[model samples]
Target: MADTSPSEAGNAPLDQMGLDNFAPYLMNRIMGRYNAALSAEMAALGLTTPQMRSLAVLSVTDGILIRELAVYAVVQQSTLSRALDALVRDGLVRRETDATDSRATRVYLT
Candidate 1:
């Protein structure tokens, strides 16, 4: 008989552990493959996933606040700041302080 134990099957069946049987483990492998292809394509464009996402968000919202852009870009605030700074230096993006709130910065595409 074929062994069904973890040592032989690699991972225990979710049903055995009483967890949801959605087969998330296999889905993770599929996602990894997809990400690898996506990263390669983005790299050819001189952009990382985060940078690409930022550009996509900017295209949709021509002038969005920096904080809101960060959320849409799906990057950490500090990481987004560095990415935005690079985009600004490259003449692809610019920042402007809100007239009503000097502390807040709005980002615009160039």
Candidate 2:
């Protein structure tokens, strides 16, 4: 049997709590494995996580606004900007001024 009791500080030690019982820890572990596997595939394709994420979103919603793409890709705008720059340089994607909004830019897979 496992001791599930909290310590004097009113927080149970991680070992006692068991890693499998922690949702956040479990989620992080799962994501770590997923990222590791994805990293290899991305490297083979010459794509980083942000770049791949951007392409994924664009595949589903082509010509999406840059701001919206950042949200959908779950990356910071600055990171997405750099990734998009590389993608554009590599000829994987293209950026264009939004037809409806001159100030906004849209991303599309090429």
TM-scores for every predicted model:
0.71, 0.81
Q: Estimate, for each residue in 1-110, the C-alpha lDDT of model 2 and write its tens digit.
A: 67665775568788877888888999999999998999899999999999999998999999999999999999999999999999999999999999989999999899
Score candidate 1 by lDDT. Answer: 0.82
lDDT minimum window of 10 residues, candidate 2: 1-10
lDDT of 1 by residue, 1-110 (tens): 76577736757556564345446766877878987898899899877777778889999997888899988877898999888888888888899997888999998889
TM-score, candidate 2, is 0.81
Per-candidate RMSD, Å: 7.5, 5.2
Q: Model 1 Cα displacement at 39 (Å)?
A: 1.8
Q: Quick one: best TM-score, which candidate?
A: 2
Clashing pairs in 1: none
Whole-model alpha-carbon lDDT for candidate 2: 0.93
The number of the candidate with the highest lDDT is 2
| Over 4 Å off, model 1 | 1-31
